[model samples]
Target: MIDSHIHADTRPFEDFEAMAVSGIREAVTCAHDPLEMLSSDVVMAHFRRILKVDPHRAALNGLKLHTALGVHPRAIPHDYMKVLEELPELLSDPSVVAVGEIGLDSGSETEMNVFIEQLRIADETDRRVIVHTPRSGKEEITPLIADLLSQHIDERRAVIEHVNMDVIPLLIESDFMLGLTVQPEKLTPQEAVQILKEYGTDRFVLNSDMSSSPSDPLSVPRTVHRMRISGFGEGDIMRVSEKNIRKFLKIKN
Candidate 1:
């Protein structure tokens, strides 16, 4: 199964090594670097290292990797315009499946401006996007993002993460894909299964959102297990856990 969204680059190397063996067939490792925290070269180097997948090392774990390259809202530096300017070239890498983990956190004007421009870049590059919605202001920010996205790009090409029950309808109305993050601070696996039960799984995907936090690396597999116990059918499970993400990334298998 594919872990559609995970900050694999932010975790300790040993943790990531262990995670690669934990039943995740593949992972979309979103960039967690706020450009200011690391030079563009340094960040790209990290992706290179992550994607290297030493044949011998990968033989042990059996995990293939993909990447998303963009500035996270919290990681946005003071000279964010400079960062955005560099993104087009950086995002051109073949291993990058999307332009994201990018969007507003506190609804700062600066973050909004940067988020909108990144959406434009994603469109221009013909890559899908992974957006981060604010934790507290879903009602306000979700539609704001929806409006901005409608102006610049196709909502179907974007997957907005961190969605909860309240924001689900708003994003659905806007025609954006929904992501449920399973972790300690965010929603749990059981809650996600219940949401899937209510809404169905056609436009939904599950993620661990496991970054530097104390979140579990096995979150997605555990969620799959929980989903089975909840009586979710295999086809529905495949839709949310695997097929939906592959469709979003435009992957064949």
Candidate 2:
């Protein structure tokens, strides 16, 4: 199985081995600035680590790690323009699968501007995007994100992530894929499976979104287990755990 979204850099090294054992053969680690003090240089280094260093770390534990690079809204720096300027070249790296961990957080103008700019870059470069929706104001922010996505990129090219019940109906009809992040703060494994039962598995994918926060690195696999016990068929299980994300990201392997 594949963990469709995670910040592997923020996770403990041992977690990779555990994830591999739990059936996570591949994963996508999205860029996020965890520190309060952010700079273009800091952001670049983070991207470099994900693109260069982290893959080797994951491989050592028997996992294939792909990456998504972008300026996260919460982590937007003072010299964010510099980071944006260098994004195209960094994104060209073969390990990069998307432009992400990018989206609205505070609902401020700056965050919106940066999010739109990344959307444009993703469109121009024809890369998939992993969009973040905040836990606090998802009710208000998600629609705005949907509207912006309509203007900036194709719906099929993005996954509106960290989704919850409040915003599910808002994105259910759209062409965009919905990311069900199984985390402590997000849905539990049972809840994620219930969602799949209600909505069907046509455009839903599962992820851990594991990072510095309290997260379950094995959440994706755990959810797969939940699906099996919930009477979900193998095809349904495969769609959420692996197939949907592979198709969404155009991942050949």
Estimate, for each residue in 81-130, the C-alpha lDDT of model 2 and write its tens digit.
99999999988888899999899987899999999999989998999999
On residues 47-69, what C-alpha lDDT tens digit does candidate 1 reach at each position? 45545543224334666667787
Model 1 CA deviation exceeding 4 Å by range: 13-21, 33-60
What overall lDDT goes with each candidate model? 0.79, 0.92
Provide the TM-score for each candidate, comma-separated.
0.89, 0.98
Best by lDDT: 2
In every candidate, how many clashes are there? 0, 0
Off by over 4 Å in 2: none
Which 10-residue window of candidate 1 scores lowest in summed lDDT?
50-59
